[model samples]
Target: MTISLPVTVSPRLSKKASRHLKERFIEFLLFGAAAISVFTTVAIVYVLVKESWNFFQHVPLSDFLFDTQWTPLFDDAHYGIMVLLSGTLTSSAVALVIAIPLGTIIAIYLSEFASFRVREIAKPFLELLGGVPTIVYGYFALTLLTPVLQILFPDLPGFSLLSAGLVMGIMIIPYVSSLSEDAMRAVPMSLREGSYAMGATRFQTAVKVVMPAATSGIASAYILGISRAVGETMILAVAAGMQPNLTFNPTEPGATITSYIVQVALGDLPHGSIGYQTIFAAGLTLMLMTLVFNLIGAWLRKKYREVY
Candidate 1:
């Protein structure tokens, strides 16, 4: 008889249900926001594949990959991506060589040795380097670093990979140092104390215990630095000549894939034309190169990340 009556929910229960529904709604919105990134990545890959498929129809894959020259504007256009690939790798290699040691040293100094005041002063200024405009870096490379290199290696060209790479290295120093320093700082103070208890000097503790523990993050920083160098456009475009040369010499002029894309975009090529579409192909190649670097970095991080 008591159950026969129609039951109405209590006001408190209704309010609780409403609040639960609101929480779920907010969660869905957050999930949707995260999903946007995946969608964006998928969109990029789709566009690249679609246009690149059309491009490959006209140009053979072998010539694109293996040919030693990239003359997409020539009467007999060659789609040799190797020329650009070499230049890109050369500058990136140079950037890594300069950035890795210097950035690591800076990170160690900041994390282990620097006074609080020095860390406060230097960290902000170092981060400021990353905020500077790429055009300024380009100009610095063209006018400043190139001149310095010209003094050292008098035979260096006006626009050479060396100058561009050096400036690019300077540009990425903040990325490497900031990340590596943060990783080193994340090491438990107890670990340093333990090292000291074992009769280890500050340098030995930092090099042996902290560095090994922070290897994953340091490796990530290095990979990201290389990625930044490879993807750089303005510095290379302005300082490194637009000529795509397949040489290992760092003092020579060269064009990276990004530079080539920038050069092509500056012109008034019709949409859907071969010249226009070639940029997409180059972009795809650059994307793949960066992807490989990221994959390698990810693998290293996974393999080396410490439980602590």
Candidate 2:
């Protein structure tokens, strides 16, 4: 009796089978990556809430929110976050005031007015400013800009919110300009042609047509710049001072939430201690502020996105 051997087919022997398997494998990898990112964000939120809860249990929420002082390291420790919040807002406001107009002007020039040669030359230099180290910017604020400001205003402190904010503004300029320019450039050339045909000059077309078309993207860029200014650490720590001042004076030394976190991190505080927990609580607040900015940015992009 003859016995027939069973036949086995290799997947590679069939091109369609191999292609199907490869597609499924690639799909799995993409899904895994997306899931990891989602879970990572969830994990971060969970950790922040858990640690912040522990902190609030020890310190009353009212005191943390409303107290005018933030001397958490002192014997008569106060948990007031407003002092830090004031400094954060003050510096951020200054940064926005400086960055918004300058950045928008730069974007407009690059997108509308600059010749191809000029734009190519200018954009790289603008982006180069962003590549400079934050630590260097901090030092520049501390040594160069602060002295110059002191010359202008004799009463300004060596480390003031004004100097820090100015330097931070300089740092954020590229981010705003680059994003806004890209948005403005993305506006269809047809819009410009239409405007030109209807008795519009280059300036008029850019201001009336392109600006409105790219408003959402420009707004998102500003929001991201604000987020950057808020979350910045080294520059604020180096030039904005570590003193928690409740006043909104730019010339005064003040601590931001970011500065406070840096201060705590540099110390040798024991794990799970009140001091350690303080940083976590402050971190959660910072996280929430950034989250709000990001949410607003996403909403603006969705609401105002131009199909063209």
Candidate 3:
């Protein structure tokens, strides 16, 4: 006999359905937050590129590219890109030097060597370093770091690339350590166990087996960290003076592309002037630099990504 079932839901059942709807709403909001990031990137790129194209139209490409001088306010000048490029490369290279080894080793130590209790305590503290403001690092570089550097190298200038680069390096160490640690930790415990079972010591197993396996992840972290170092502005502004000289002397004062724009933007350069356009051009250059690093990081992740 077929019996008709009554359409009924208890209060508890209805409440559960409401809860599921609320949960879905929250999940959707979180995904929307991620979507906004892509929008932000696009907006910034549009502004930079649009204004930069306007700049290139007015300023001759040859003078901006081949000229070895940059005097936007002077009677005659050459706004060559090499000077700012030098500053970016200098700071980034110095940071890479300090970050790669320190970050990689710390990552290894934290993931493989530190006790469980130690790791629990260490990770948050290490990540905290990365969260510190870049401006604070800049201040520390100018006031604290500069004085110490002067004592160490008497001939060095007060505000120079050395001070900025070193500060930037210290600032980025946390990023490298934290990200690389995650990569190293992703390796299966079984891999380490197998290496150990083959009579390898902990360090040997880490270097010979685990590290090699996690190479792609580490490389990706390194590239991303490099990108951070390159794009950093505050430290360069405070410690590295705004003098865009075509020299690689770390002891000499020099300006990064960012510092130059900041200097110009601070009412010194009026809107719609050729000088104003210079900033946009500089922004485009910086954008391209960042894009290059991002591509490199992506390539590394794809090429060396480990499943296990």
Candidate 4:
């Protein structure tokens, strides 16, 4: 004989509850997405470190560091990392020399000088250039660029770092120019107007006022270009002959750490073998090199960051 009454939530309160639940759901989704990337990066680093540790166990750290020859596959294996390091450095140097100056100039032109019509038309072309496969560029370097280089200097080998580096620079030009131009264009128009009021020429405004204001973003672009140059694989693999030599000569054919890894990866080396383990060690080295460059870039950005 109990009298029971049901209690119901008000419409407003129910609606608010629903909204709160939806917001939490969206936030959780975003958090999950971010966590995926972090987890993947951590997993990659763990694998590389684990395998590299296994490699170091078999090869002494001193010999790996101090050796001048890299013949890990040969019967008398010598693990001088410098042989690959030299090639990597030389090729990267050549690429940077071409990319930095050219990309900066292109960015300045597009950002400051190009009309709206020209900008619209040119941007797509630049993006298209970036989208082309790296393998096509590799073959172009081998078949076309190498022949052209031979005409200029007959002593230039068919498969040399110069050919590979030059092509790689061209391939990455869009990456540098596009990012740099975007950074430059992001500079406030008021800054340019102020420079003009101060009797600065268009070139002066672009070079001095705008460029300094956009330093952080431009530094980021340069860093991306450096990373691209350092990590380029097929162009160096197919164009630069896969020969391990400890020399900083771009005109000569040599093997980079990347090319060596590719060679070993495509070969039938058994898993867990010493030769197979070298790829992980080389990968760790490459990752360290990229990390150093990124740190330098970060420092540059911090040192030159502009609030306005």
lDDT per residue, candidate 4, 1-308, as tens digits?
A: 98898999887666687788999999999999989999999998999999999999999999999998899999999988889999999999998888899999999999999899998999899899999999999999999999999999999988999999999999888989999998998999999999999999999999999999999999999999999998999999999999998989899999999999999988999999999999999999999999999999999989988876
- Candidates' TM-scores? 0.93, 0.91, 0.88, 0.92
The reply for model 3, stretches above 4 Å from the true place, is: 1-35
For residue 208, model 1's alpha carbon misses the true position, in angstroms, by 1.1
* TM-score rank order: 1, 4, 2, 3
Query: Which candidate should be chosen as best, given TM-score against the real structure?
Result: 1
- lDDT: the better of candidates 3 and 4: 4
**Reference-based lDDT, residue 209, model 1:** 95
lDDT of 2 by residue, 1-308 (tens): 99999998896686697789999999999999889988999999999899899999999999999998888989999999999989999999988888988999999999999999999999999989999999999999999999999999999988999999999999999999999999999999999999999999889988999999999989999998999999988999999889889989888999999999999999899989899999999999999999999999999989998886
Candidate 2 matches the true fold with a TM-score of 0.91
- Residue-level lDDT tens digits of model 3 in 1-308: 99999989886667677788999999999999999999998999898888878888877888777778787767775678777888888877777888888988899999889999999998889889889999999999999989998998999888899889988998898888888888888999999999999999989998999899998889888987888988899899899998887777788888888888888877666677778888889988988988888898888889988785
Model 3 root mean square deviation, Cα atoms? 3.8
List the pairs of residues colliding in candidate 1.
none
Q: What C-alpha lDDT does candidate 2 achieve relative to the native structure?
A: 0.93
**Candidates sorted by lDDT, descending order?**
4, 1, 2, 3
Predictions in order: lDDT: 0.93, 0.93, 0.86, 0.93
